[model samples]
Target: MSFILFLRQLGLSLAEIKAILTSDYSEQTLLLNKKQALQEEIARLQALEQTIDDQLQQVNQQDTLQVDQPIHLRVLQRLPFAQDFDLSVVETIDWQPDWMLRQLYYVINETDYAICMATPAVSDYQIDAGCYVTTTIEAASGAEFDSALAAITTHQTLPLIGIEMRGTFLSPGKHLAVKILGNRKE
Candidate 1:
């Protein structure tokens, strides 16, 4: 017999039958509540998954754009200077319209040394020698200081460039070389 009919036959009132069906520990009531909670949780997780997928798509698009861009590098100038030259003088450097100053590379053939470069009455700075020292003006101010040293130490290759070298401490017959590298957009 139907449960509701059985309850009616037992003389249970309508309110008592309803109370038993809707009680907290009833099997049907517990299963229905659990099913609703799981549905809600599934919806929340699906939304999170969609957000992550959107972010991944944006990253992939940026990567594709970067790969399509072309990078063109060229040697802007090659400057040679004496190992023991004074570095407090200023000079101007020439460049082509297509060339943009990007990086400076200092090649030391002699023993390691320390170098300094500064703008006249503006700033003073120092740099230590390595197999090669690289600097980029595109970076922060501190980074530009090192790049300026690499550019200026090689016979004032850039305008208003002044440099001083110390700790040459090289064995006899050692020398130094400096090269300036630049880039342009193709």
Candidate 2:
């Protein structure tokens, strides 16, 4: 019609002059590659949310301690040569030992149970460092075969390769405690 009115006075039109004569920048290079893949997926989810808040602040930091010693029912047999683990759940730990270890685990009074220990770590994997220990016991219900026969007439100084019979279900008094499970693996 006048060369489309001289290409609409030069502002072009006929489909922007056929997309600038075919050099069609694929819709602005697909919106700049979808805005650089959403800014690298928001910088890899903010570096995985700061690596899950620094592993939840290293499990909310811990270095607890609670001792007065008095409770009994011990057994770990031996651990001088080290290297042998199998805490085959002999159940009885209704969970309770975080309130600064329950106010010193209620000041060793007729302790229903508590025998947490750890130190092994010469490389066979690792554990030492703050090497832990928490004593307190009083069992009954098949108390894991009397704690493996009181680790052969007990006289320990921390040498009972194994004895996992934790407790916390007595909230009534008396004795007959139970939780004697087992495990094996040399």
| Candidate lDDT (C-alpha), each | 0.36, 0.35
Clashing pairs in 1: 87-163
Each prediction's TM-score against the native?
0.22, 0.19
* Model 1 stretches astray by more than 4 angstroms: 1-24, 62-186
Kindly list the per-residue Cα lDDT of model 1 for residues 70-142, writing each as its tens digit. 2222322223443332233212333322111122223332233222221123222222222222222222243
How does residue 161 of candidate 2 score in lDDT?
24
lDDT of 2 by residue, 1-186 (tens): 664565456455689756645775565664576578778777667655644543343244322222223223322122222222224332333333231222111101121223333222232112223323322234444454456435532444322322222222213564432222111111
- What is the lDDT, from 0 to 100, of the residue 124 in candidate 1? 28
| Residue 13 lDDT (model 2) | 68
Q: Model 1 TM-score?
A: 0.22
What's model 2's overall lDDT? 0.35
